[model samples]
Target: MFPTPIARTSSGTQIAYKIALPVALVLWLLPLIAVALTSVRSAGDITAGNYWGWPTSFNLLANYTAIFENTPIGKYILNSFKVTIPTVIGSVALSCMTGFALAVYKFRANLIVFFMFVAGNFVPFQILMVPVRDLTLNMGIYNTTAGLALFHIAFQTGFCTLFMRNFIKAMPFELIEAARVEGVSEIKIFWYVVLPLMKPAIAALSVLIFTFIWNDYFWATVLTQGADTQPITAGLYSLNGQWVAAWHLVSAGSIVAALPPVLMFFLMQRHFIAGLTLGAVK
Candidate 1:
C-alpha cells in the first residue's frame, strides 16, 4: 500500500520527481524570501509601493540596528527564551512520565486517560481565549512570562503525551519485564533503560515545542503584553507607531524572531530526523 521510493521508480517517474523537487522547494521558500527581502528594503522603498520589486537600497545593518535602538526587541527576545525553554522542558518531562506510565503499566483507566489527552488536542484553542485570559487575571499573573509558560506547558502536554506514548509503546516490553525479574526498581528501569532509548524522541519533541512556543503570537498576545513579558512574536507589533506601521522594522523583527527556531532545527537536525523516522524502516 505504500508508495514506491523514488530511487526504485521508473525512469520517467524519477525524472518527473527530479524536475518537481526544486520547483516545490522554491515555492515553499517564496514567502520566507519575500520576508527577508522586505527586511532589507529601505523604509522609503516600502512607503513608495516597492514591495515584491527590486529594492532601491539595502539598509541591512541600519534596519537591524534601528530595531534595537528604537525598540525593546532585545528584552522581548530574552523573555521568549525564558518562556520557551521552561515550557519545552516542562512539557517533555511531564510527557515522558505520563507516557511511560500509560505505556508500561496496565491500568483500568489507561485508554480512557489516553483518550482524554488526545481529546484536548482536538479542542479549538481560540475558543479558550476568554476563559484562559480571565483565569490568568484571577491568578494575578495575567501578563507574566511564568503565566504564559505555564499555560503553554498545560496545553502542549497533551500532544507531547500522545507523541511519547506511541514511541514508548513501540519499545520492546521485554526490557521492562526483564528489569522486574532482576529486582530493578521501576524508576531505575525508566531512567536507565527507557529514557536512554528515548533520546531521539526527547530531542525531537524539544525542537518542536521550542518552535511552537517561540512562534506563538496569539496566546502571547492573549496572556501577556508589553516588552517585560511578551515574546518576540507579539513584541513585533510594538514596532508600530500609533498612526503608522513600520513594515520594514516589523519584517526585520520577524526575521530576527525566526532565527532561534531555525538555528535550533539545524543544531538538532540529526536527532530530529532520527526521531521522526525512528520506526519508518521497520
Candidate 2:
C-alpha cells in the first residue's frame, strides 16, 4: 500500500487558506456572475430593486432574442467575426514567415530588425492611433471592417513576430542542418519541417489574437463608425446608450458578445497552454 504525502501545515493555517480560496475566487468572478444573473432577471425585477435576488423567471433566451431582434446585435457579431478571423490568419501567417527569416538566417541587420519589432509591439496604441486612423481614411477602408482588420493585422504582427521568432529559436537547429545536408531547398524545409512543428505556436497565437481582436473596443470605435461595420464591443457601447436602464438586455448582449472568445479558449486550451509555455524548457 502506498502512503499519501501529508501536507504539514498548521491547522490554523490550513483553515485560513481554505477560507481565503473561495473568497478570492468569488472576488475574481463576482462581476461575471452578477452579469449572468442579471441577464436572466426580469426588467420588473430590476425596477423593483431586486438586482441581486433570485430571478423572477429565467428569461435568458427571451433577453438574448430581444437583443438580436430589436437591434443590430447579429450584425455586430458578424462584424466581429469578419475582423477577428482575418486578422488572426493574416497576422499568424505573416509572423511565421518573418519569424523564420529572423531566426534561421544570419544577416548584418537581423538583430536590429527583431529589436524594432519588439519595440513596436510594446508601444502604446495611442501613439499609433492617430496615424493609423489617418492612414485608414486615406486608404478609403475607414468606417469599414476591412479598415479595423487591417490595422489589427499590422499591429498584432509585431507581437506575433516576436513570439514566433522566440519559438523557432528554441527548436533544434540540427534538423535544419540535416535537411540542408540532404540538399532540401529552403522553401521545402520551411513548408515540410518547420511548419509542422509550429502547430503549438500557431494554436497559441490564434486564440490569443482572436481574444484581443474580439475585445478591442478602442480600435473598433476609432476605425468604424456605423452599426453596419462596428464590432460587438463597440456596438455594445452604442447599445448601452440606447438601452439606458434595460440592464437585463444589456447584460445579455454583453455575455453574447463575450461568448465566442471564451468558447475558443476552452476548445483550444491545450494548444494555448503549450504555446504560452514554449521556450520554458531549455
Candidate 3:
C-alpha cells in the first residue's frame, strides 16, 4: 500500500488557522445567523432586549403563519414567481439565439456587437431606469408582473448574451463543421449540438438569474406597486415598516423570502459551479 501523505504544520500555526476559520465564518454569516435566531424569538423577548439570546419559546411557525395570514406576503411571493420564471425562460431563450449567432457566424460587426453587449451589461441601472419605466408605462403594463418581467428579460439579456457567446465560443468548432459538412441545417446544429452542451450553463444562469430577480427590490418598487404585483424583496421592506419593533416576525419574513434561492443553490450546486466557471478552464 502506498504511504498516506501527511500534512505538516506547526501546532501554533494549526491553532491559529482553527481559530481564524470560525471567526471568519461567523463574521461572514453574522447577519444571516442573527436573523435566523431572531425569527424564533417571542415579541416579549425582543421587547425585553433579548435580540441575541436564545428564544424564550420557539415561535418560528407562528411568525411565518402570521405573515402569510395577515399580510400580502403570499401575493408578493406569487408575483415574484410570475416575474422570475418568465424572465428566466425568455432571457435564456433570447441569449441562446444571440450567442449562437455571434459565436458560429463570422459576420461583419461581430466584435462590435459583442462589445456593445458587454458594455451595456456594465452600465448603471439608473441610466436605464427612467427610460425603461416610461416604456413599460407606455406599453400599459406598468405596475404589473408582466411589465416587471419584460424589463428584466431585456436587461438581463445583455449579460446572458455575453455569457452564452463566450461559452459557445469555447466549444469545439469542428463539431459544427462536421455537422455542416453532413448537410445538417444551422438550426438543427444549434438544437441538437449546441443546446445539449449548454445544460450546466443553463442551470447556472437560471439559478443566478432567479436570485437576482428575486432579490430585486429597487426595480420592483420602481416598476410595480401594491402587494398584488410587488415581489417579496419590496414586500419585505414594506413589511418591515408595518412590523415596527416586531423583530421576530420581520426575521421570519426575511428567512422566508431568502429560502428559494438558497434551496436552488443547494440543489443545483454542481451545475451552478460548472456554469459559473465556464471560461475559467481555458
Candidate 4:
C-alpha cells in the first residue's frame, strides 16, 4: 500500500506538503551550501573569523590550486580511485554470481548459505576493526591500496549479494526454463539472458557502491596511512595546518573529493532509477 497521492489528498494536506517540501530540502542542503561558499573564501576572511559572512574576496581559483600544489591531494584522489574502482567491480561481480546461484538453483542448505551472507550485513563493522587490522598486518598488506580494495570487496559483498539476490528472485524464473527447453547451457543462459536484464541493476549498484567506497573515511583511516595509500576522504586532514586549521583549503578539497561520485550518479541516473523502480509496481 502506497501513501495517498498528494493530488487526491485534502487541500490542507496538499498545501502542507507543498510548504514542507522546499523547507526540508533547504534544511538538508544548508551544510552543502555553506561548504561551497567556504571553498571560495579568501584566507584573509578565514583569519578574520568571518565564517558565515559574505566573502571579502573570492579565492576560488587560488584555494583550489593551493590544495593541489601544497598537499598530496592529487595522490590521495588517485589512491581513492585505485581503491574504489576495483572494489566496485569485484564486489558487484562476486555478488552477481552468488545471487544467480542462490536465485536459480534449488539445493539443500541454500537458505543456510544465503543467510550467512545476509547475517554478515547485520554485524557492526566496528567490532571487526582490531581483527581485520591484525589480519592485514600479518598478511603484510596493512597500508596498501590493494589490501584496502580487497578488504572493501570482502566487506561490501554481503550487502551487494542481498541486493542482487532479491532483484534476481523477482525476475521471471520461467525464462531459465525456456532456455533449458531450447537446450541452452546454464552458463549461456546466464550470460545471454540474465546478464542483459541485469544492466540497470548493475549500473545502480555501481553508483551506490562507488559512493559508499569513495566517501568511506573510517576504513580508509584504519587500514591505510600516508598519502601514498590514503583515499581523499581520509587525506583531507592533511589540508589542515599545525597552528591553524585551513578551513578554506579543506572545504575546497571536500568539494573536489565529492566530484567523482556525483558525476558517476549523474551518468547512471537513468539506469539507476529504472533498476530501483523495475518491480515496484504490480
TM-score of each: 0.86, 0.92, 0.93, 0.88
lDDT of residue 53 for candidate 2: 80
Q: Candidate 4's error at 179, in angstroms?
A: 1.3
lDDT of 2: 0.92
Q: Sort the predicted structures by TM-score, highest score first.
A: 3, 2, 4, 1
Colliding pairs, model 1: none
120-209, model 1: which lDDT tens digit per residue? 977998888899999999999899999999999999999889889998999999989999999999999999989999987898889888
Which digits, one per residue and each the tens of the lDDT, describe model 2 over residues 14-58?
A: 788789989999999999999999999888998998888889889
- Which segments of candidate 2 are over 4 A away from where they belong? 1-6, 10-20, 274-282
The sequence of per-residue lDDT tens digits that candidate 3 reaches over residues 46-139 is 9999988788999878888988999999998999999999999999999999999999999899999988988998998899899999999999
User: If both were scored by lDDT, which would come out higher, candidate 1 or candidate 3?
Assistant: 3
Of the candidates numbered 3 and 4, which has the greater TM-score value?
3
Give candidate 1 misplaced runs (Cα > 4 Å).
1-24, 240-245, 270-282
Residue 55, model 4: lDDT of 93
Off by over 4 Å in 4: 1-24, 241-243, 270-282
lDDT of 4 by residue, 1-282 (tens): 269889998999999999999999989999988889999999888889988888988999999998888789999999999999999999999999888899889999889989999999789879989999999999999999999998999988988888788889989999999999999999999899998888767887888888889999999889999989999988876555431567888789889999998898789887666654655876
Which candidate would rank higher by lDDT, 1 or 2?
2
Residue 163, model 3, lDDT: 89
Measured by TM-score, the strongest candidate is: 3
lDDT of 3 at 233: 94
Q: After superposition, how far is residue 99 of candidate 2 from its true place, in Å?
A: 0.5
